[model samples]
Target: MSGGPGPGRWLTDRLSTLLVVRMALERTGAPRTAVAGALRWMSPAGWAAAAAGLPATVAGRHLGWAELVVAGAALLAVLAAALVFTVGRQPYGVDLRLSSARVVVGERAVGAVVVRNTAARPVLPARVELPVGTAEVAFPLPGLPRGGEHEEVFAIPTARRAVIPVGPVRSVRGDPLGLVRRAVSWTQVHELYVHPRTVGLASGAAGLLHDLEGRPSSDITASDLSFHALREYIAGDDRRHVHWRSSARTGTLMVRQFEETRRSQVVVALSRHEADYGDPAELELAVSAAASLGLESFLEEKDLTALTTHEVLPAVSRGALLDALTRLETAGGPRGFVAMARAVSRDLPHASLVVLVCGSGVPVRDLRAAGAVLPAGLRAVAVRAHVQDEGVASVGGLTVVTVAELDRLPRLLRRAVR
Candidate 1:
């Protein structure tokens, strides 16, 4: 029993082995760093002296001066390396905030990142990286005392309509003299919506409503808002709508005839293919035009569906329309814009009005073909956004409007068929 290993000794041995193993792994992972730091701390000259004095120390000469120095240096390096790798927390945490979730192109939006050092102990300075779309911004953070905080403001670019990914701030820490480095992510990613710039216009310009009452139908109904003509009152005719003066003058029971008023639907089909707009400006204008029409449709509280090259977005609310517009990219897949437009138009034959916004690069013949595919009695309008200014015209049974600039979208949209 006396010769056997004690429980305390066994536990100490296990802990020591684990510590050694962990240190070894860290050193191996940072070989260049460890070597560089060791060189700076203990020079080649010092190493040579340590090696030279090793045999003398073994012989019990001069009380092992060089050996003691080398051991102390090695222990210092191990402790430093361990500390460098294990401090994973930053003094401050970051909260990302944007002034507005939705903004128009060419408009400025401000964002603030609130960094707070809520730790109980003073923390070392660190570096933070914030991702903005394709760009990365680096911030050199200053060391903060306990419970200290700072706020930083940044500008978000709205040159184009898009949903930009903003954050997931990352903190980086490292030794001063090429020793060790570590990185940790602090926040979640956020999206900033940049909506297309548009102009205010009447819903009638989009052909959604022919008149105040609505689109008229050939089918006659017993009772309706739109007046058609006066006729002799039948047995089932409601007396409330009887034309009393006309009945007295004619000595007969007469009732006002009315046509059926149908609620109109406006569908905006926009070409999202890059090929459709060879010029970037044209594409931007096209987006602006579509956005304007969609806005009008929403403002008027009419049934509206915004269509891209291949997808359909129902503009149920202003937020939903803007969200879809923000996320719509230039490329719309392989089916191509013309074909997709025709297919969509054909499927929505019942729609009262359909508006197509495309880049200038699209051919007039193709636009005509797209219009021809629409269901009978459905009206269609085409808007071509381009750099070369052109007047409005009608080709192949569809009215085409030309928009040279985004600012003139309202004026040009007024010329559209009602």
Candidate 2:
């Protein structure tokens, strides 16, 4: 046997023994009811006297009434002190504050939790637990002064894009004797929304034709003049193109051939309608195609605008247009493709390209009705599955591109514009 116990070993052993005794008492019928009955049967002094008399009875030794009275008084004093400490020593309040209630993806977010001592006396908190997403963290508060606050910062991880929910913090206070612990829960909730990541594409889509052009070929034609490039004049070239300034410096003539700038303007219409399970994939493909076309046009420096039935209209700029598309990914509502197209045609310039990205379930009559209102030169391309009968033959002098044949959109667009 060991001659002496290690630090805190004696205290630990005492607590273990007390727990076992408490559990044993509890298992014998209803311990709480029994304790209540015991308390009712005798006064504190009478209970103390009974406890003091038990030792002598077990030892079969004679004990005087005066000695028993003194022993009982001493035991009562200790019990009274324990009752006071158990009730008045524990601390019981917690508060949490986040630097920002909302956060974006890939951003560093921080929060602080404050533990307060509501009791009049000091308390040693065993542990405080905070819930974050699918995990939980526990922190220790060795000692907290009465009416004082302890603050700690917690870091939020940025591994994925999503909405994260934080907390209903919990605090646990253990008895000084380490035999009993009390737990309390707090109500606090925080929300964070993570945005999507975007990568820029270097290739331009200016040369690619859009179905909204209402033309038949992908070749570039010389109808409109937009500045293309300046090059050195070659042999057999017209001398009228010679630049006197350039001849004076390098003795070379620089001629400018303005590249034909197409008059085609593109309008991308995104339907905000909710699709059924069978058509969700098709709908997503349509949306991606529309976004790709819009981005390509913007990069090529083509005039383009995007509209959604869900209250988003991005200017012709690439960034603003992309942001609109990103929002369209989670949009919900009824199909406003026909109505949106009619509005765009009426408000925008004539001969513009109207590209409608819609689900397969739109009524063909609505498409035909919209087609009648569009300008003579304006072209439309409706994207949907072939299964859903969109009875639309031609809308606003535009052509419909079935879901199965969507791959030919680039070529179709070039022809439409020509």
Quote each prediction's TM-score.
Answer: 0.70, 0.41
Q: For residues 329-400, could you state the per-residue lDDT of candidate 2 as single tens digits?
A: 445565565677777777775535666766666676766776676766554666554433323344445566
| Candidate 1 residue-wise lDDT, 242-293, digit = tens | 9999999999999988898877778888888877886878887887788888
Best by lDDT: 1
Task: TM-score for candidate 2, please give it.
Answer: 0.41
Q: Candidate 1: RMSD over Cα atoms?
A: 9.9
Cα lDDT of candidate 1 equals: 0.75
After aligning candidate 2 to the native by TM-score, how far in Å is the CA of 291 from where it should be?
A: 2.1
User: Which residue ranges in model 2 land beyond 4 Å of their true spot?
Assistant: 1-264, 275-279, 316-319, 329-335, 385-396, 404-418
